[model samples]
Target: MSEPWTLHPDRALPADPATRDLAREIYAATKDLPLVSMHGHVPVEWFAQDTSFGDPAQLFVVPDHYLTRMLVSQGETLPRLGVGSTADEAVETDPREIWRRFCAGWKHFRGTPTRYWLEHELVEIFGVTQRPSAETADAIYDQVAARIAEPDFRPRALLDRFRIEVIATTDPAWATLDDHAKLAADGYGERVLPTFRPDPLLHPDRPTWREDLERLAAASGVDVSSYDGYLEALRTQRERFVAAGARATDHGHLFADTTPLDDAEARRVFDAALAGTVTAAEAQAFSGHMLFQMAAMSAEDGLVMQLHPGVLRDHASAPFAAFGPDKGYDIPVVTEFTRSLRPVLDAFGHHPRFRMIAFTVDEDVYSRELAPLAGVYPALRLGAPWWFLDAPDAMRRFREAATETAGFSNMSGFVDDTRAFCSIPARHDLARRVDAGYLARLVAEHRLDLDEALDTAVDLAYRLPLAAYERR
Candidate 1:
C-alpha cells in the first residue's frame, strides 16, 4: 500500500546530488527566519476580533481564490464551493460539502504553488497525516477543525506561532481605520500595519469613482469638489494611515504609465470624471497621472510606494457578476515599464528619501524592463515574483532572469501578497527554499562562497524586506 502524502524536508531545493546538498544547507539556514509579510490582503478584522476560524472550508477553501480558481477550472461551480451566492446562484452552506469538493479536486492543484502552500499547511501546521481526496476529506477536515478550535489557534495566537514579525493589510483610501486604531490600542498596531490603497480614488473610469471620492472627503474632512482639494484629501488620508503605523502604499493599476498631465489637463479630466463624462482615453491618462502624483506624495512623506500593474480584474464576467470581485478571475496582461514609468522615475529615481518597489505579473518585464531600471536607480527596487508568477519554477526563472542585471541588492525580497492568513508562513517558506536553491547554484559554481550565500539567503528571507519597506 502507498503511504499518505507528506511534505519532504528538502522540497523545492535543487535536483542535482551536489547542488542539492548545498541547497539543503542554505535552506536549513533560512528556513526558520521570521516572516515579514510586508504586502498582503489579510483582513484586519481577524486580529481585531481574535476569533477562531470557523471550519476547515471557511479557513482554507472559501477565502482562498487560488484554490477556488483551480477548482473552478476543473468544472466545479463557484457557489457550490461556498463562494458568494446571488439570487441566481445558491451557495453551499455545508462546510463539509465544500471540503469534499476541494479534496476531490486536489489533483488539479499539482504543479501550482497553491498545492505547495496547502500541503505545508496540512502536514506542518495542522498535523494532518492523510492525503486529501474524496475518501479522506472528512477525516482531514475533522483534524483541521479540531485544531483550530483550540484557544491557541485563534487569529492573534496564530501570529505568534507563525513567527510573522510584521504583516501589512491592504486598506482602501476611504476606510475609517477604526479597526486598525483598535489594534493599536491593544499594542498590536505596529506588528500588523495598514497599507494605503487608492486605486478607486485614482481611476476616473471606474463607476464608483465619484462615490469613492466622497468617501475620501468624509474620511479626510476635506472638500473634494476641486482637483486640488482632491489631491489634498488623498494626502490627508495617507497621513491618517501613516499615523496608524502604515509604511507603504499599494497600487494595482491596469497600466504602468505614469506621465503627468499639465494643470489645465488635470483639472479638465477631473471635472469630466466628476460629471461622469470622462472618456476612456482621458480616464486612462488621468489614472497614469495620478500614479505620478502618488509617487510625489511618497517622495515627501517617505511612504514606500509599491506599484504592481498589468492585471485585468474580473476576466470572466458571468462568474464575477455572481460572486463579485476576487473570485479568482483576475488575469495578467502584458505590461511595460521603461517608458511608462519614466515620468515618475525621472522625478524621484535619485531622491534621497524616495523609495518604490515595482511588482508585476508580467514576467517578461523582469529582464527587459524592471531589472535594468532597478540596476541604476537609487530609489527603486524590483519586487519578487508576484501573483501568477509566484510558483516555484516561475520564481526560479525570475532569479535566473533578473539577478544577473539587478543582482540581489536591487530586489525587495518576497511579499506573499496573499488574502489567506494561514498560508503566510507557508508562502514565506516556499520563497526561502527557492532562494536557497538559486543561491546554492552560485556557491556550487564558485560565484559566491558558502558563507556569503548564506548571508544573501538571510537577506532575501528576512533583512531585505525590512529595508525595502522602510521598516525602522
Candidate 2:
C-alpha cells in the first residue's frame, strides 16, 4: 500500500502546542477573508476573454516556472511538461504524456511548499482524493480536464470562487491595455486591474533597450529621442494605464538607487542609452532618475509605487541564451537597502501622498535596513518576502525581523506574486499560516496580547496589502 499522504495538522504552526493553538486560532479567523492579490504576472487577456482553461497540464504545469524549474533540475526536460519551445519544432507532442511525466516526477516535491500547494489543488480544487502517481495520473488528469470544461471553472468564476476581491496584473509601459479596457467595459473593472511595470523601458542596460525605447515611442505616439519627449510619452502611457483601472507602478531594478541627474547629465545619458552605449553607472543613474520621475507621476496620479529590488534575473547564461528571461534562472543577491534607498528616501520618503512598498531578495537587510527605514519613513512599507524568500521559513524570518520595528502597519500583508493561477489560494494560505504562527510565538513569549495578536493576524491576512496598494 502507498504511504498515507496527508498534509500535517501542524502545517506552518510553531512546534510548541500553546503557540500552535494560538496560531491555529489566528489562522482560522482570517482564513476565509477575501483574497486581495495586489501584484502578479497573470495575463489580462485570461479575464478579458473569460475563456475556459484548456487542460490540466496547460493550466497547471506549462506556464509556471516554479514547477518546471524543479522538473528540469531532475533532468526532466521542459518539453515533457508542455513548456513551449522558442523553436517551432520542439513543442511537446502530447499533453497526456506530459501529465504522465509530471505525475511520475511528483515525488520530487515531497516536503516542499510546492508539493503542499499541488496536493491542495488536487484535493480541494479537483476533489482528487488519491495521491498522484503513475497509476493515478490519468485519472486525475481526466477529472481535472472535465472539471475545467464546466461553466464554473472559467477564470472570472474561479476568481469569485477563490474569494479574490481584486487582482492586479503587471504590464509594461508600452502595453495597450486593450484587454484591461475590455474587462472594464465588461464591468469587471473593480475586480481586475493593471500595474505599470516600467523595467523594460527604464532599464538602459536591458538587452533590447534601444529597440524597446523605440517601441515605447511608437506605442505612445510620442517621440522618445529627446528627454522632454520621453517624459511626455511616459506620462501619456501612465495615464492610459491609470484610465484602465491601474492603481500602482512596479519597478524591478537591480538595486534601489534613486537620485535625480541634472538635465545636461540626464540628456547625455539618455542619448547614450538610445545609442545603446551607456555605461553601467550611466544606466543606474538613468534608472534612478526614471524612478524619481515615476514617484512624481505616482504622487500626481495616486498610483502606489512598488520597488522590488535585488533580483539577479537570468543568473545562468546558457538557459537565458536558449530560453530567454524567467526560465527559473533568477537568483537572489546580497542587497544594501539603507544606503541604496537613501537618495530616494531623502527626496520622497516622508511625502504624505507618496507611497512605496519595498521588497527585498536580501533577507539580511530585513531587520537592519528595511525595518528601521519603514518604521520611520511615512511613505515606506515592507513588502512580503518575495520570489526566493516567499517560502515558510522566509516568511517566519521576515515577521521576526520586521514586526518589532516596523510592526503590522508598516508591512504590506502578503502578495503571492505567482504566475501559477491555481496555486494562488494555497500560497496565501501558507502565508496566513506562517503569520499566525509568528504571532503565536509573540503571544507565547508575552511580547504581545492575544487580542492584539488577533488584530495583527487579520491585518497581515486581509487589510495591509489593500491599504498598501489600493487606489489612494
Top candidate (lDDT): 1
Reference-based TM-score of each model: 0.98, 0.95
Stretches of candidate 1 exceeding 4 Å from the true structure: 1-4
How well is each residue in 1-472 modelled by candidate 2, as lDDT tens digits?
7665566767778888888888899889888999999989888888999898888888888887778888888998765677656453376868788888889889998867788789878877888867888988898899999999999999999998899999999898899888888888888998899999889878788888778888789889999888889889999999988888888999888878777888889888888887778999888888988888888888788889999988888887766776777864687778888887787788878777789899998889999999999999999999999887888888888888988899889999999898778889998989988988988888899999999989988898889988998677
Task: Report lDDT (CA) for all predictions.
Answer: 0.92, 0.86
lDDT score, candidate 2: 0.86
Over 1-472, each residue of candidate 1 has an lDDT whose tens digit, in order, gives 7787677888888889899999999998988888999999999999989998999999999988889988888898889999978677799999999999999998998889999999999999999888899999999999899998999999889899999999999999999999999999999988999999999889998878889999999999999999999999999999999899999999999999999999999999999998889999999999999999999999888899999999999998887777776674999999999999899999999988789999999888899999999999989999999888999999999999999999999999999999899898999999999999999999999999999999999999999999998743
Model 2 backbone overlap count: 0
The ten-residue window of minimal lDDT in model 2 covers 80-89
User: TM-score of model 1 relative to the true fold?
Assistant: 0.98
- CA deviation > 4 Å runs, candidate 2: 1-9, 86-89
Clashes of each: 0, 0
